[model samples]
Target: MKFNKFSKCLQIGLIAIPSAFAMSLTYAQDAGTRVAVVNSEKVFNESNLAKAMQTRLQNEFTKRQNDLRDSAEKIKTAAEKLDRDSAVMNEAERVRRQRELADQDRELQRKQREFTEDLNQRTFEERAKIAEKANLVLRQIAEQRKLDVIMQEAAFVSPKADITDDVIKALNSQK
Candidate 1:
């Protein structure tokens, strides 16, 4: 009976603490009603910074693609030049051609990987810059409005309100 009472008291305490905290939060919220939210995705997509980053990414991709095409063309040419007359071609010549093709393939693969890494790194840097700038704007807006809480609009389940416009105005003014 003593052990049962102890467990019941522990459970009651856990529930009571959370209930009290909830009531306190309600009271606090009632005292002042300042809140805001931002749509970061919208900011990143619509910002001029995003356009600049896209242009840079396109140039990098295009250059890499052109180089890969040139490599492929050279390999194709070599393949076309291969004499199917096995009887006429020496073993050394055949081995040399095979090695050349293998080397070209390796080079193409390496270039592709490097291009991918560069693109990824560039994207990381661009997003980091944009996110930092947006966050600063968000904080400024929150402070200006005396907001008690600022949240991501996308994260709110019901989305009772949207402060995207206010945030966007702040971001643009920072432009």
Candidate 2:
């Protein structure tokens, strides 16, 4: 009984493999011949538009970032002073200073969290803008060259199939 089951399974597997291959061949024949690949990392790094956007974002956020740094420094200074002077104070004065330090530390932490969230949100927005612009250029290149498909970050794309330079050129031309 086991041998019969094994034979049946082997036959089914053999039939299915051939059928799958035939279907794939038919689909390949119907598909367009032109294909292209894009290196997304290269596009992001080399594009003039990306560079300009990064610079703009950095400038826009620099003041807030500096403020955060200043606040952090102030908190550090306060903590250091509390550590140095606590031993010299009376119990009530020491406790009061500790409480004040804790409050200041909590406030700084809250501000730091807010700063991080805002920075991350703005960075994402700027990156999305750069990606959208790069995609537009990619589409333009694909359409101009009659590409059936354009894959990004393929593991093994041939140099001939890489259209990243064209997309970067298109982006730079807009500048």
Best by lDDT: 2
TM-score for all predictions?
0.70, 0.78
lDDT of 2 by residue, 29-75 (tens): 68856788998888777788778877887898889889878888887
For every model in order, what is the number of clashing pairs? 0, 0
Residue-by-residue lDDT tens digits, candidate 1, 1-175: 9999999999999999999999988988889766666777777777767667788788868877788889888888777677554457899988888888889889888988887898889899988988888888777877877787877755553454567766666666665
lDDT of 1: 0.78
lDDT of 1 at 101: 81
Model 1 pairs in collision: none
